[model samples]
Target: MAITEIPKGFKTLLPDEANKREKILTSMERVIKLWGYNPLFPPTVEFLSTFKAVDEKFEEIAFKVVDRETGKLMAVRPDFTPQVARIVASSFKDEAPPFRFYYKGKVFRDVEGERETYQIGFELIGVNEPEADAEIVSVVVNILENLGLKSFQIDIGNSEFIDGVIEELQIPSPTTFIKLLSSKDISGIELFMEEHHISGERREKILTLLDLYGREETLDKAAQIFQNEQSLSAVKRLKEILEILKSYGFESKVIFDLSERKGMKYHTGITYEVFHPLLGCSLASGGRYDQLLKKFGRDLPATGIAVNVDSLQLLLERKGIFKEEKKDFYIIDLKKERKLAYEIAKALREKGFSVARDIIKRSIEESVKTAFGKGYRYVIVLNRELKTPHHIYLSSEKHFPLDDKNLIESILTAVKEEK
Candidate 1:
């Protein structure tokens, strides 16, 4: 088959795209590191049982293979949380409590088209306090703010909150409630209530409460409607988290969603999805999964978030957030005064300037046009004439310089001043 027909849903990232993605990833890593979270990198493949130990349903979406030597089943990781759990259990078993770690890498999943995706995130283990939860949320908010994402909402929810309410209803079939909640199907929940001899008043009230999703007011309404003590306590905890976010001055971006419950089964506490208006879906998502570490024989509490770098790039493009301006530089002559040209380019490069040499034997006009086409603002003409020295010409303005050093410095100064 031809190279063009290699496959679908797999494409290369050009220089510009790659640069933007790198900026976002670097920003996220810097933010997480600032919050005292150290970095860790696990292998891309692990024993299939590692994932299955947490959720058997992952077997279908995971890409499985057989170890040629041991004949053991292995699979590409679909998520980072499970692998981090296994690592903590094996290596850090005797370590101190509250081990915070971060990671950034590619994860594989058999979704609609693409089987591989880039996931940049972190995992905090061994800390279960409310302070730890607040710290995680603060880190997420800071990272988003630093990315220049102005208008986004962090919708926070608690699994125990919704699950406790369903249990308190004493419904004959809890599985139906789980399905209804998972699907966000209010009508299905109503039908289940009607079939189970639940009161119409209670069913309608609960359905209306599920739809009331936004801000701290949602928690107030939830507290009023939920009769279960555990569920009400969950609401209180969410409110406390909101208050902590406010103390960090992130109240404007926080939103409380009581019905938001779409994560892995291990997430037992606060869960959230960060949504921006430009991107229809979430750009980042994560929550507190205190019980996940226990499965690896290391019982501890942890909460963290993962930013979808590619999704973030998409959002930035849609919002016109990141616009890269090309650097201005001069291409020195290769024929006469080659040493002088090299010296000129070296001097400019040391000052954090971009300089290119015309070694391709192209004409001056061709080189100028090439520079302009590549987004360079100015082009420098170099020759061995000191009496009437070389000069820099801007694409926008037509100006000639009398001296070589003055011309080069003028171009560099111009670019710096523009910025």
Candidate 2:
């Protein structure tokens, strides 16, 4: 392998990709903030003990490191939701209910065939009502809508329903059975059910879960088969969430999935996974984890969603949804008016323009060529002795005077009125 080659599943985002990612993050952050969620930054590294209560699967894929000072093992964060729960449990133990927080950052994991990725997510804490779950669903739906994602489906399910069935039937090693449900293995499920002596009208209902996925009527089918209170309650909760989503006009995008196993042990309530028809993997996934915070110290009911931005970025690129950032300013100072150029650049920056100064000892033609090649929309040439028409705006090939009086204001207006 090359000496500088990064490890498998690690990525190095170049400028254009990073810029696009920043734009995507900004778009998501704006919507999250508008929904009354404040930003919360979790630590990149935590003592391994912090994850003791989380799903055992996280430990297997965690990037572990040794702490030099303490001689203890620490792990780079493999997920953000657990850290959010940790913070709510310990950091804000005394705080009141309904903590709304959003975060966007990198998470490193050792999972094979999966890239270390950037995640944008939000957590709503201290609410156990179905409205809270519905609210988070609406929030993510709004986020995807803002990003112009129309060809996607949010598969919503409640793990409690499935777990309750297992508990009621005394199913052994529930994970194995859950896997069968996830894959819709009708024969495998039948064989497992037979081996476990699980045969009855309920067996038929268990098989029914494999096909209980579709429009709103899918929930009605589930309700008819679920006789147990826990399963019945799940159907009711789903109905409530669906009704709330209907009120938000996002119900059309939801598909009721009764067989989706919860992503983690912490997820105790409604769970959802977002999928795109064009992508083989999930584009986003999250759910309610009411018991996770209790492990950290606080007992709070919370729900959240994490959008797989890397996957979404790729999908957006394929869809050609992003445009080049071409409004940046390029100032070419052929005459050594370094200080004046700096002042102009600063002024443009203060007015919310990204300015780049040409510092190479090149001719005016070459510098302007470089600026245009780099997709800079506005270019200005500086003069040694300031005079009327000494500078030029190359975007329109029109020369504008560089008078000292009202220079910044005139230049700002000369660029463009549109931001």
Candidate 3:
């Protein structure tokens, strides 16, 4: 007997889908690198405590395994940022003030039944000022525009603002109130407020004034409700970040959501989530984790953004922005000139063409049919002649001389003319 099923929430990516994902990751990585971020590849597994150091919440969903060598506990990487923190403390401890790194990898979690998803993210360590946070936010906004995203918004908020709101409300169970507010239970929130004797002006302000704080005026309206220094400071910082975004001409792509306090436990300051009208969930999210590095023995300030490649790929595919790459030339060997076939394939590839040689022992007609079916635009049938193979266009009966002297030029001309 054999196991025929993968676990629930896990899925394999075939060629087409995988190609889309890779393209999305590539575009994101390019932008991240341009912003002075070097690439870092964290291992797929680490000690369970590495992740738990950031947040014990990871212990629940993290896939744990026992190490036989040391008999200590280890686990598959549930997230990359924690591993980055570990590296910063253990490896780059004596380095410098500001360290910038970007990464692309998969993270495992049991939130939706033990699924693994790809993440392409940037981590800027050793910077505490709001400029660091602003840079991260602007980089993401730049990425969205670079990827041709026309309609999207980043919902920004601060944990201090949220905590102040809870304080101002003076509710019995802040935890329960937060849960209800997070789920947007209008009736439930009202009932809870009534239960806590939170009526009159406070209730009216929350109900009518803070429906959706997207515009600048709404930010002011929301600011009027919170009186605590932390919340007011959160509001002031948000306005400063907005001014910075305005300098980048990206203020239009931003909105404020004071109710957004739910994120990774490590996010201690301003947090944000990316949204589009078409997707039901956030496409990317990040925040300032000023205290995460302290767990690793380095009290460094950090901020970063993590893009959900799986979700981004889904959105791109739905928009038909990315498609499966097609082969440029398919080599079908008719005379069994194996050496010539290999040489021709290599030559085509060297000339910037994607070529695939016929591996299956099949007839020329069958091979040609397969090439056409697989979306190849050019097909070459190799025979006894070393100097020339019949280069046939898969779309029509047109043929070109596949001479060694002009192999690249001929293909380039053909592709240019086709375009």
Candidate 4:
């Protein structure tokens, strides 16, 4: 057999890229933690039935394999919210309202384009108030800003309004129209309506949904078009959520889009999509799913947002903001000086310095070149006898000797002075 490739839509991040990814994740964790959101670890694989329980549609997108032990189907997690919901319903069954969780991991799906994606997201569970929705929006803004993303927009919508309109209109096969609306394929929706012989006031009202977007005033225009009480209430809820976001000073970051039903399958109420100019698709997307926990044998309201970590990393790269700071010290240990070099390296690391010991056998000159190439600021050379004052190569081609007793302090002082 020929050599098999690693399959499509999968990427391996080299050390530099991986370092940047970790920095992005760390920044996101810091912001989320500031808001009191604790971390949650959901299993990467779960019973296939658990996923189908929330949305049968997931069966088409989720990857599955038979469990060797149980002889049952297991699914690689396609989404975090469902697994989180399962945990909340079963593990935290007795826990009170308002459980906030933040997660960072890979979600697998048998998608046509990308099979796996990195996601950093948060979930707010057991709250039905508009405040919960506003919190989700605020958290998204905070994370993006903290990550140094200067240009981004959050599009907001109410899935309940779309569902209610479909129910009130008694439209057949609403799913197709929902897809068309999600893509903003207005012409396709019009064609679909025409094909279904849907005209008159009903068709016009459905068409009006596409036009309801942009600033806060759009909510006023939406209320005038919605006839169903549920749809009206959804608009009111969205308006109230916007008011809350406004109070948080994120009003300008939001745009109302009633036609956005992308997550309609599981999202029961308000939905949102985060976009940046660097990518055509959303950088993150999430919404309120009040009924998702019910599938796990509990009733709870929840809202969540999942940031496309890989995409955000790309944005940072394009903006030249994702950079890995250089390591502080690279110590070259001659074969005979290994033990002493190890001791010095350990002590440096204990004092909060990034220290690397060279285990590879190379000449002192080659080791110095390697250290500079690897972006290390200071290079310490241990001779065969491991002399008391080791040779130190400073950044400006200056060479000096640092005694073993003053190694840590001298290196730190040099670093601080350079800074």
Candidate 5:
């Protein structure tokens, strides 16, 4: 038998990374909950058909297995929105409108080989209004700000804005147009139009307009080239959304990208991606998927956003924002004064401090050295033979008698004040 090697492009998170990741995730969940978005946990594996209903491309990268007894094909979920939609359509059909739910979990996607990705995202279902969009956008912005991330931009785009323009052109197999738009391949789009014998002043205008890819001004430029009512309506919607974002005071962080078109197959209206100076890719991506609920037998509108927690941690680390604080410990000598030591340790523990009592019957020097080496700040020494009471010793200072009971309170109070 041969010994197997560890997998590539995948690594375990060590103590430091795990601690930072946990803190960021906790903050994200806290903000999400504060925004009235309840948490939901869905299974990591589901039937293959559940995901295929959203996009066939998912099947290519999905890890699949066959049930031994039932012989049903199952897949590890590559995304959460599909499963979330499945849950809502199945269980919350009779529930009221505007269901806001948040989730944080691992999603498996086999990009090259089997790789597991973790993401934290939220879904706002049964609400099509711009207020819901603003709420979702604002929630994400708030989470990022709360994480202490600076120098980030949230680029907003509308799928319908581009789709409406292409629909009016009646370009057969608009996949070419979509690809060219997504890749910012202006030459390819022009060449394709030429091959299709699309020669006119409007064609020249559209080709020139593809370069309009940033800021609110781009919307006006796109509106000029797009004479189709559907395209114009999409432009109007984009402007309205931009206005909403501005009203939220996130206008500076918000930028418009007309050529930005990822996740467009499932997304019906507004789509957004968050970028930062440190990340090579977007830290988070999401938008409205109005048609997702319809697949689950409910014809309701919905939208969502998903933050890549792993990527977010990377950004935070690169920005030097997520440094872990040293753990504080209170060490007690249980052997010297059993009763007093237990009482002091119990008191410290009751105060919500991490208390590590030294049970070893070692010399005072050995205990003090051990506690100091182990990163304990305060060491309480109890001398049973001495006439005086227990004395608390600071690692920075020498031992002293603390005769007063209020001294313990004073020490804790001082520590709290320092923090």
Candidate 6:
């Protein structure tokens, strides 16, 4: 027989990693709920046409399969926002304005590496005001902080500015130009500009946009260089959103950049990405996609962010942000008094304690030694006498006889006293 092996770009998280991931997700879900966002779950698979319009760029990355029943191309979810849009537009088309939803799930991308990924995200639909944008950004800040990320920054950009620039400039092959700018391929852009006879201030303005990233002053610089209405409007929206975020006391985590033009084809207005020193890539990214729902038959404005849960978990594990609760008590009871020991263990657990009971009977000495070896803080011995069980504090090796009538209370009190 041959050996069985796991496939590449997939991983099974063992206890330690899984535990941390759960804690991070719990904290994020709580923070998201606190901000009045309701939970949402889009299907894991949808027809290929559902994402074909807005997510053409992701077609190569999406894992596609043929549905034998329908004979249509179906794909595992590559992103949640588009699926969310489809549901909101068709399922809740006439529901009303301003729906707030949060989601946590795994998304699959069929690239050569890391086919499966996890994301925690939220969306604010049918709202176009700057406040909606700020709220989404605030939620991201709150979630990262709640997850114990001490140092991180969000770089904000406006898709409108670049789109307006391309339209106003009538640039040929705009997508390729944007890709080159995203990669910061200066030589390629310079050569392209020269080959196209684009020289002097026109070329300078386009090239200078690459360096427009920093504090509030960056917006001023962008406004100065791109005097067109659309570019200036983008700058104006960015400034307004910044002011709103400043009022929320998140100014220190804000950075303005106008050169971020990737992963924003569907984003109509505000776009942002979050970074941390611990990771080479972005820890989270999101933005306003006002035009996304239009493809689904609704014209609701929307903005949201998706945190790379896997990346955040790695950072937290590296920094030791979460620790497993220590096992507190181990119960060893005589055969005849096993029921009483179980009752006591149940009571302790109901009161929010981690209690473990031995499945097999052993001598008091053997049980105590085993509990200590397994790092249990205390051991309780219940014999047939059922009068008082000896409580042994493993670290101090001190013994106390606990009254049976008040066993639960006495054990709890003893543990507290030890602390």
Q: Count clashes in each candidate, considering only residues at least 3 apart in sequence or on different chains.
A: 0, 0, 0, 0, 0, 0
Whole-model lDDT values for every prediction:
0.78, 0.83, 0.81, 0.86, 0.79, 0.84
Spell out the clash pairs found in candidate 5: none
Runs in model 2 lying further than 4 Å from the true structure: 167-173, 190-203, 384-419
Candidate 6 lDDT (Cα, 0 to 1)? 0.84
Better of 1 and 6 by lDDT: 6
lDDT score for candidate 1 against the true structure: 0.78
Q: Model 1: per-residue lDDT, tens digit, 141-198?
A: 8888888888988888888877777677665776667777777887787787778878
Please report the candidate that would top TM-score against the real structure.
Answer: 3
Arrange candidates by TM-score, descending: 3, 4, 6, 1, 2, 5
Stretches of candidate 4 off by over 4 Å are: 1-4, 167-172, 198-204, 384-389, 403-405
Measured over all alpha carbons after superposition, the RMSD of each candidate to the real structure, in angstroms, is: 2.6, 2.9, 2.5, 2.5, 3.2, 2.5
Question: What TM-scores do the predictions have?
Answer: 0.91, 0.90, 0.93, 0.92, 0.87, 0.92
- Model 6, backbone clash pairs (residues 3+ apart or across chains), number: 0
Name the better of 1 and 3 by TM-score.
3
lDDT of 3: 0.81
- For model 5, what is the error of residue 300's alpha carbon versus the real structure, in angstroms, after optimal superposition? 0.5
lDDT of 1 at 88: 90
Instruction: For residues 320-382, write the lDDT of model 5, one tens digit per residue.
Output: 886545555555554543776667667878877777778777777788778877667777766
Which lDDT tens digits does candidate 6 get at residues 284-330? Answer: 88898988999999988999989888888888877777765457888
Error of 2 at 172 (Å): 5.1
lDDT of 4: 0.86
Candidate 6 clashes between residue pairs 3 or more apart in a chain or in different chains: none
Off by over 4 Å in 6: 1-4, 168-170, 360-376, 384-389, 396-399
lDDT (tens digit, per residue) of candidate 2 on 156-265? 98897887777776779788999888787888988998888888866877777778788889878877776678888988999999888888888988888886576667
Give the CA lDDT, 0 to 100, for residue 5 in model 2.
94
lDDT by residue (tens digit), candidate 4, 233-263? 9999998998899899999899998865767
